[model samples]
Target chain A: MYTESNEKKLDEIISHYPVKRSAILPALYIAQDEHGHVTDDDIRYLAKRLDMRVNEVEEVVTFYSMYSRKPIGKYKLQVCRTLSCMLQGAEQITEHISHKLGCEIGGTTPDGKFTLQEVECLGYCDLAPCLQVNFDYHEKISTESVDQLIDSLK
Target chain B: MTKVLTSRFDLKGEACDIDVYLKTGGYQALAKSLKELKPEQVLDEVKKSALRGRGGAGFPTGMKWSFVPKESKRPKYVVCNADESEPGTGKDRDLMRYDPHQLIEGMVIAAYCLNAKDNYIYIRGEYWYIKEILEKAIAQAYERGYLGKNVLGSGFECNLYVHPGAGAYICGEETALLESLEGKRGHPRLKPPFPAVVGLYGGPTVVNNVETLAAVPWIIINGGEAYKALGTEKSGGTKMFTVSGHVARPGNYEVPMGYPLMKLINEDCGGIPGGRKLKAVIPGGSSVPIITAEESEKVNMDYESVGTVGSMLGSGGVIVMDETTDIFETTRNVTHFYKHESCGWCTPCREGTRWLYKVFERMHRYEGRPGDVELLDDLADKILGKSFCPLGDAAAMPVQSAIKKFREDFDRRIKHTLVQINKAAD
Candidate 1:
């Protein structure tokens, strides 16, 4: 279960649409936030609630990068590895985050506080080499800021 | 006094500045409507305003919102279709770049009216800049308590998140967008559980368009009646028409939706940059059928009107072709994009887009068999409605229409490709 504030907000958030399918993404977001990341059971719950075929829901949730199917660490670091971000040295930043976290590109840290994933385009070309941690987007990040942001998250 | 729609929400120096957005009239509409307007009243205004979805479909915004029954007890959603990967379409990118607040305001107001709290803008991966702009705006909205629980003490709390999509043309489709938003490959599902009925983690949803959401705050602030006064009957409000290809002024232009297509290409857009003879016009992106120069006088920037002129106003991405450009080659380029971007979710779109480009490529290379034109038409028709998504239609429409409208040009191009090659060899 999530915090009361999250639960209350999530319920109200889910009620805004007419169809149950609309709530899947939000529910997933909340579930991910609460349980660190999503699980098969969470998706199953989402499918049953939204009236979607479980297979249908699974295919979609698995396709997009934003939705984490597995439970991730506390700090879900999604570094932009698309064209613009890559042009700005996202590869180097990815390595730095990997080095700092002592994990692989898609691996989480030992303490389970940080999970690094190479995501496609965070849509911050102006401040290239961007990484979004939960709701906070750290823009124009260098290797040092990555460590600082990661350190602060822990 | 009324101020500009999207002034402060654009670029600040090189970064997307939330502080600048607050310095201006950003979030003012949500702030004002916190305690005043009920959800129905806002929906009613949108219904009255008759604002159509700006994301090509042109469905009525209020009607689409009303489709979600209020008593369902189902958690609802608001997904902004910002996946503008259409080749000629650049309007949404500009809107997000220049005035992200308009979209944020629109989404916030739409969420309030639709009785939904969570919203996501499924943006194109290529628009990394827009992601920065929108996320900052949402964060600012949260900081100001415009978002979060008990919004503005009105008990109309809503949370917003920015979800960017990999550049898949299919993802622009609402259902496909839901799939992509769910972290799946951007492939559309069969409708009827239409995304509004089943979307985003399988919840009752209202997947509104980016341009459509950006118009909401304006509709709410100015009153739907006032908003209705902007453009023509049915097709109201100013539209962002992106004109590319052989035009001198190849960029996004905001004119009334009812503005004459010729005038847009001529006056507002500074007609054909080099004064070259006009060949053809894809009046509304590559999805719509290409309009010939002869039919140039008839086109206007709207849904129904463009169809009357033997083409559709799909996304208002006007691509102008000059005399120097070959219709066969132009189509080859367009079809190739569709082919490359097809998600292979549906066979018709997957096969059809590939066949379309391949046939055009053959015709372009002067390697067409005798009945290639007829074959092109037949192939286009075969894939027309057989696919799961409109992408099949998007792939087939222009190719079939272009050949129908200008078969002679294709014929001539084949002759030129073949005969000219032989002549050069001699």
Candidate 2:
């Protein structure tokens, strides 16, 4: 179900690289952006577009953490739970978000407004206890701030 | 002791804008390199400066460039490692955010030295915002004829692109980076055909860190000896130390190589927050050995000094722990990171990391066995140098060091658990 415009954009991405297969990562990103996750159908479309076996695209989807095999929530709250952030209460923040949303770490809220994830270091340790909501970084967050963020998201 | 690399950082009024960069003497080095010096001469100057790769390994930059085969028939490549996925490291993000064109200018010069027609900056997927900043800067560079199609009329062409990494820490490793760039999973290839010998697209390639490439402009402009005069005998030039965790001023501090570790913590970072006493420090990134708090004060922020203290000056990611910190819990957290990031290429790394994390997880829950520590030591010994890449060794180093240096913490956990079990039995 690749649109004409999407196919055009794919062409531009392919033109940037000497080898056409190098376009797979960026192509997957585009598909994920449109679909919120890569489904079997999206994988088939990408495999055909990039001229690869379906297993090749599926391997990529499984290997990297960012690509979601299942549909994700509107606001994916990826909290930094690595060393520096953990030391500064990232675990507490994750628990707080998970509790407020009535969902587990990787599960979406019942309303599907939020998905809480405990991620490794986002490399923004100076502002520890950070979380990214849909690629927008919210640094040095607290439970209270996360509460406010959830309120603001809806 | 002037601020060479970070001279324009944190300045007001569109810090990353092209006009602001130009006003602060941005492309002058690029112009000079294209107009005045030969590519070999540029390489020689970097060689003389003794700039080490800032992406953890600290290999000499000029020496790395010298490895790119001069007679290769295939198209050479220069891949800039902007992944910066190591825990406690945020300096590269700051560099890309605040001073984008500086990195671009550095990459241009580096590409020239290697005779590479095209270059790529493989950045972490999380830093999409910073990557946008870099792309804007690159567009501006091209508009001004600084990047593409015979850059600055020097009869040399250079094209630069930004590639986003899809959330894998192993891609930060040079060989894995090339694999990911080539649309494969981020598994690091075996050495002997090192990247310099056969890299991206089966061509002789040179992979350098973003921080290493960014220093090229300054080295070329001020000359190599001047840059060399900035730091210690072997470690020359200023390094961006990412001082985080338990510090008052948790931020990126660019200091000369031989800067005192205590001074950086006390003066620059305003010491530990809330006046807590220091317990220990990961003087480099989490992969390196952790130095005890007592030894950290005597440490210098250089390669040799940190190494002499039994830890390499890795990635300049200084993670400080205060008296209130729990060594056992922190070790579990660190172990968990390696276990999650191990690429599963080698059996030792894949299995060793998983078991290492499981042992720590059990201990944190007070279910540690009597010989768990010995079990850990044996597993680490088996994994140390046997894996395909450093991922296995990285998992082993900090865990091994923590158990050795802080055995009391592990003993305490086991004893507390056993006491609870006996009380329940009674």
Retained true contacts (fraction), each candidate: 0.07, 0.81
The RMSD (Cα, Å) of candidate 1 is 9.0
For candidate 1, the chain B TM-score comes to 0.92
The i-RMS of every model, in angstroms, reads 7.7, 0.6
User: Lowest summed lDDT over 10 consecutive residues: which window, candidate 1 chain A?
Assistant: A120-129
Q: Rate the local accuracy (lDDT) of all candidates.
A: 0.72, 0.89
The best candidate in terms of TM-score: 2
Candidate 2 runs further than 4 Å off:
A3-5, B415-426
Per-residue C-alpha lDDT of model 1 across residues B41-138, encoded as one tens digit per residue: 88888898878887888888888988886765567888888887565666777678777767887888888887777777877754656687787777
Q: What is the lDDT of residue B409 in candidate 2?
A: 82
| Tens-digit lDDT track of model 2 for B148-191 | 99798888999999999989999999999999999989999988
Candidate 1 local Cα displacement, residue A7, angstroms: 24
lDDT of predicted model 1 = 0.72
lDDT of 1 by residue, A1-154 (tens): 5578977866775565445565565566667767766777777776776688888778766654566777678777888664334434677999987887789988888878878887643434334557878556787789988877776764
The 10 consecutive residues of candidate 1 chain B with the worst lDDT sum are B1-10
